[model samples]
Target chain A: MRSHQTVVDSRLRRRRTAETVFRFFLLASVILVSLILSIIVVSILWKSLPALKLSMIFKTPGTGYYLGKRGGILNAIVGSIEISFGATLIALMIALPIVIYLNTYLKKKSFLSEIIRLFLDVLWGIPSIVYGVFGFLLMLMCHLRASLLAGMLTIALVELPILSRAMDETIRLVPNELKEASYSLGATRWQTARHVVLRQALPGLITSTLIALGRGLGDGASVLFTAGYTDRITTSLLQPVATLPLAIFFQLNSPFPEVQQRAFASAAILTLLILFISLLTRFLGRKLSRHRIK
Target chain B: MDKGRVLKKEKGRLVAAGLISFFPIFLTIAIFLLLLIKAFPLLSLKSLPDLIFSSAWQPQKGQFGLWPFILGTIWVTATAFILAAPLSILTALYISDYASVRLKKWLAPVLDLLAGLPSVIYGMWGTLLIVPLVGKFLAPLFGTYSSGYSILTAGIVLAVMILPTIVNVSVEVLSAVPAELKEAALSLGATRFEVVRYVVLKKSLSGVAAACVLGLSRAFGETIAVLMVVGNVPVAPVSLFSPAYPLPALLANNYGEMLSIPGYESALNLAAIILLLIVIIFSLVARLYLARLSRRRDR
Candidate 1:
């Protein structure tokens, strides 16, 4: 009996020790993520300080800046904004309809919706580079050269799955009873979706669109070949345009120290843009959650 | 007339919805077809085994072997999964089982932000911070020459980039474990940790596995960031510190120039096809596993 009791005690002690170690491990992991985030922010800022000027936001990238003269990445900034906006608009137009159709046209557990979702998942899992390759192929097929329109089309493809998935989740949360109520009031499915579903999911839809926008703006690989880089900003969709990520990639690859500093500055700008979008989405998400029908 | 108008409107709406719904399916098939069509030229250029197993990638000499790139991609992605899996699962567990409501709220957005951040920024961060640290500090300890751009640096950056995906999916899985199940475990004299370990983790094992699969898919497909810090070497890496090239990186780095050389376009297209196939398989497996996990939970 004494030995049995000792064995039990040892087992209990071992289990307790394991629990403690696991708890510490969990805490360390969380802390490590937070630490990396702060480090990324701090290091980018530190490195970018030499070239991040208020004037940089206004001036176009001067040619031969790799020779260590003055310039800004405004051209890339404007180009990024144009491409992202165009892509997000296009994605929203397609995604909103698809998500609405998925939720409304099909039964809640419809196999069609399941299959559609699986397709989107596959598309979502495809790498940005593959999308770029596809875009490049499309460009070739059409006998079209690289341009902003090509980039927008490629990014639209990339953002479609993300936005649609998000909107689908939110639309699923719209109470079935509310749709029933709309239908009982003699509303058509299209009217019900427009009036009840869209109204209810407006906040979430906005947030999802913004998230997709952020993705479209920040993606480099998808646009690398499709949107051939240019030194100057072009308003025309036919013209190739530069973007912050490609600019940073190009500048970072240069042998010049000043060009490298500019890469850091571009990094800072890109980070700030994404951070702004993220914070906005978070704030909107919180607000929507508070208003959500539990 | 009024009833006819209503019927016509309904038909129009349904048709519109059906057309839109078909778009994703159409797009998926189209992408596959496009890849296959463009990559067909390589079929005559080299045999399948020779193309994939040969190690030399001299474009000028028309030698397009993919074995080295495959090896490098596997090494970087496997190392990233190793580094990210434990941390991500633990963080997910903490958030789901241990965190307060307020903390959960705070953490969710940050993870979302991390998930949404661009891959290029990750590459930039890898270049600016990880590479230098590896070159100046870590490489010496590993007995490798310092260039800051190696398989290890790329793996570390990919690890960070993949963490949010794993954590988010794992949290969703753990959260789906019914509250009563956890309560019962606690009532049976299990400590909080014990309940989490035996009850939550066990129940969510498949879901966590699914999350890891998704993360692997992401790591495999990631391009510019991995391209930036991976040193772009075409040879297979012998060690973590050695410079290597991944499939996506190779595709991205060479696709532009591929058009200029004979048979190069077909080679790059084959690489993209390989990447697409691997990522698609991983994603489908993940989706299936997650579906099974949820079904089991529901039962």
Candidate 2:
């Protein structure tokens, strides 16, 4: 009896040890991920602090900027805002309508909606470089040069699936009962979508737009070929535009230390902008959710 | 007359929505066809197998063998998956099962921030920190030398870039597992860990697999970050320490200056097509699998 009890005790001890080890690993992984995030933020900030200046945001890169001359990244900053904003606006116009149609006009889990969702999923997974290539081809076909218009079109394709899917999920969250109430009031489908669904999904729509904007703002590959970079600020949709991601890429690739330092500064600025947008998303999501009905 | 006007407006809105909804489908088809048409010239020059399997990549000399790049992409993506899959899965498990409410709230925004950061920033960070650490410390410890811009360095950076996707999806999947199932295991004298292991993980196995596949797809097509740190060598990588070039990098680097060369544009377009095909296939498979899994569960 004593031997059997000892055997049971040993088995229990083994199980207990296994559980402890497993939990330890789980905790370690969480800490490791958090540590990596902090490391990325801290290291970028550390390298960029010495080179970052207030004037960098206001002035355009002058001649000999790549040779370590004095200048700013205003051209890139302005161009990035223009291209991403243009893309987001274009994506929203299409995405909002499609999302509303899917959620309200069609039955839940209809075959057509399923197929559309599948296509969006695949589109979301396509690499930005592919879009760049496609955009280049489209430009050739249209006899258009590498310009801000081309960049906006390419980035719009990138943002479309993201915006549609995000809005689709959010619009799905609106209760059927709400739509039914609108219908009982003799409202048409469009009126119900505009008044009932759109009102309830306003916060989600804003959040989705912000997310797509962030994506477009940060993406470098899709614009690499389509948005030919220029030192001067873009004055027209037909002219080439500079962007922050390309600024970072070109600066880092330079053989000069000062140029590389500017690269770090550019990265810092982009990271901070994206970080602000992310936090704003969370804050806005919460503030807007107060108006949502459950 | 007012009611008639309202009806007419509704009809117009429906027609507009229907047409706009087809735009994405039309765009997808156009992209694929354009790539195929552009890539056709290269296929006429060389067989598909030769184009894909040949190791020589001198664009100036008219050779466009993509074997080295194909292998390089496979190596870096596999390394990233190996490094990230476990960490993300465990992180998801911890967040869902072990993290306190306060910790969960704090972690959400942190993960979102991580996810939102651009690839260029990740690449810059890798170049500044990871590249030197590998070139100086890890390589020497392993009795080798590297310039810190190697496949391993790229893999490490890419792994971190993809962490948020895997973890977020897995957490969603794990949280969806019935709480009652976990409680039942606990009531039957199983420890919390065992209950999670036997019940939660078992039930959510397909979902976790889908999350990993999604992460893999993201890692596969990531361009700028991988290009920045991946040494951009055209040779196939033999070891983790070797510099390599990936397909996206190849497409991005060669598009502008070399269009004057014969067949160069077509070759680059073919590379883009290959990337598109791979990413599309993987994501579709994962989505379909998840759909099937959920359908089964619902029944």
Candidate 3:
């Protein structure tokens, strides 16, 4: 009896130890994650504090953007927004029909569906540098240098998989029964899908689109090559322009302390934008959870 | 089976329509078609070894060795995997086997949020926090200047970045473990730790390995954050404090300028193609394995 009780006690004690370890790890993850985000915010703010003067925002870089009075990121900022929005608009226009077709037409796991899925997975994995290079090369053949339109197309390629997948998943969540019910009421397949399926998946579809937006904005590598950083903002969609992420990148590498500080400010703005979108989607994710529950 | 049989009545239009359904697949093809055509000049059966194994990357001298960047990517990814893998696995084990509902409710979302946080933001944080922290505390002891970027710092930041992904994948695997298996282990007088280590972990190691590999790939191709914090030197170095460059960073940094030259431009395009190949292979293998696992679960 004594030996048995000792064994039982040891087992219980071991379980307790495991629980304690688990608790510690969980707490550590929380702290680590929060600390990471905090550092990003704090560092950007700290770096940007000295560089936030009005002159820094309005002028162009001279001598060095940071060292002299002419260094302003206005062109890059405008360029970034233009490219991002343009890419977003273009990618969505393409991805929406694809998603609808996949969910509505390819309802089962046929060979075609499987192939499409595999291709998408591969597309998602393709490096952004590849996209940048490819876009640059193709454009060069057409007598085009790295331009805003080229950059937008490059980013559009990157975001399409993310958007398509999200759109597909959201569309899939639209119950077949609802579609069938709609079909029984004498509606065509597209009409049934349009009215019932899309309505249910709106939130998720929106979330996916937002994810693509975030990816496009955060991406530096693909943009650096295709956009060809320029200080002057232009109205033509085909003209060269700079984006904020690339601006931060160039400024970070600059020898001038002032330019580096401006880089930090840009970094701050970019991080805040990313965080806001992530947090917002999460708030909208409540609808997603509700969808999952069904 | 029955659904297919019933559906086959309309097989003519249904199948053709189904085939036509993925017309968006053209997007994927367009991506590949354009990439291959652009980077085709880089694919030489002659310079294959030079491209893959040579340590030098000076395109001016006609040296196209990618070994340095590849090695750097591998090293940092391995370091990050070593740091995050164990912690993530244990967290998953606990979450799947022991954590209560309320705790999961709180913790799961936090982990999800971790996954969602952008790499750029992570880079910003690393440049500010990890760089100084390492420069101040770690560099002096190692007889080096922190220079605010190191493989060690990059690895640490990447470890954190990928931890949630590892944890999420592992938790999914662990949650799918059969209750009967656990019950049988307990009936045989296995302790909780023993059951998890011997039964749960052993059974799920493949899935965990897959998760780790996937995370490693993410770490390998990671840009922005790694670029910001890494010293961005092209040469290999033994000390963690010494700056190093990986292929992804080098490609992004140099591709623009290199485009001005012709053969040199093709060489750079080739490098980009290689990067794309790596990502596709890694993703496809992982996805196939995952898809198989899910299929098994359904059965």
Candidate 4:
């Protein structure tokens, strides 16, 4: 009896030690990932701060921007905003209808919805560079030059899946009882979707659109071939436009240290835009959730 | 009430909505068609197998072999998976099974932020940080001339970029493990780790598999970040320290200049088609597995 008890106690001790060690190992990995992210953000800020001039934020890229001369990424910044906003609007037009169709037209477990979801998933996973290639092909077929319009169209393709999926997920979460109530009141499917469901899914729709816009703004690959970079700011959709991501890419590739610093500054600005959009979603999501029916 | 007019309007709305919804399906088909049409030149450039099998990628000579790019992509993606999978799984386990409530809350927002970060930012980080670090430290150990731009550097950056996807998905999977299941395991005198290892993991295996597949898909499709640091050499990687060119990098770097050459556009389009098909397949598989998981939950 004494020997059996001692054996059991030793085994328990071993197991306990194993558990403790394993737990700490897992914790360490998690911490390491977070630390890496923090390090990246901090290093970007550090590299960017010294080069971030007040004039750089507002002035357009000059001829010698790549040669470490004085200029700003304002051309790129305006182009980024113009194209992303255009893309967001384009994606919203297509995505909102699809999301509405998914919720209103199809039953929850329908095979058709499943197929559509799979299609969206596939699109969502496509590399942005592939979209760039496709956009280039489209440009060839149309005999169109690389322009802001092409960038907007390509970004719309990139943003479509993400925004649609987000909206679909949120719309799917609307309580069944609400829809049933609308039906009992003799409302048509379109009416329910337009009036009741739209009201409920508004915040989510805005959040998803902003998120997609933010993604489009930051993507460099999709615009690489479609939007030829320009030094001066142009509002014409037909004209070639510079964008922040491309600006960062070009400047970083420069051998000059000052140009590299400017690259970091552009990156810092891009990151700030994304972070701001994120914070907006969180704030808006919380405030709007109060009005959401449980 | 004019019931006929109301019915007519409802039918019109339904038709409009249905047509609009058809846009995604139409877009998918159009893209596939367009890709094939654009790549037909390469496909008919002898045979598909010859183009893919040959090792050289000289567009000028009309010898458009993609084996090196394919191999580079596979090597970098595989290396990234090897580096990321264990760390992500462990992190997911910890978050789902061991972390306190407060820790979970804190971790969630951090992961969200990481996920929301742009790939361009990641590329800049990799270029400024990982590439130099590799040249200064890692390459010398491998006895390679340290250019700092290699498959390994890109792999490390890719691993970091995909971590949030893996961890977030795995956390969702593990969290979906029923509380009752864990309680039953504990009641039977199983240790905490044992319960998690046997019960929680077993239940969430499919979901975890989906997470890994999705992460792999994301890593494979990523372009700019990998392009910035992967050296852009059009050769198969013989070692981690060797420069390599993945397909996306090849497309991004050469598409502009290649367009001026005959048959080059077709070759790049072929590469893009290959990328699209592989990514789509991986995503479909992941979604299929996730669908099974959700159905199981419903049951």
Superposing all C-alpha atoms, what RMSD in Å does each candidate have to the true structure?
Answer: 1.7, 1.2, 5.0, 1.5
- Of candidate 2 chain B, the 10-residue stretch with the lowest lDDT total is B252-261
Computed on C-alpha atoms, the DockQ of candidate 3 is 0.34
State the DockQ, from 0 to 1, for candidate 2.
0.86
Encode model 3's per-residue lDDT on B151-214: one tens digit a residue: 8888888898888878888888888889999999989977677688788888888888887767
lDDT of 2 by residue, A130-245 (tens): 88888988998999999999999999999999999999989989999999999999989999999999999889989999999999999999999899999889989999999999
CA displacement after TM-score superposition, residue B157 of candidate 3 (Å) = 2.7
Alpha-carbon TM-score of each model against the true structure: 0.97, 0.98, 0.86, 0.97
All models: lDDT? 0.89, 0.92, 0.74, 0.88
TM-score for the second chain in candidate 4? Answer: 0.96
After superposing candidate 3 on the true structure, give the runs of residues whose Cα lies further than 4 Å from its correct spot. Answer: A1-15, A22-26, A49-65, A68-72, A287-294, B1-45, B94-113, B142-148, B177-203, B237-241, B259-262
Which pairs clash in model 1? none
How many clashing residue pairs are found in candidate 2? 0
DockQ of each: 0.77, 0.86, 0.34, 0.76
- Pairs that collide, model 2: none
Q: Which run of 10 residues does model 2 chain A get worst, by summed lDDT? A: A54-63
* Residue-level lDDT for A38 in candidate 1: 77
- Could you give the candidate ranking by TM-score, starting with the highest? 2, 4, 1, 3
Docking class of 3: acceptable
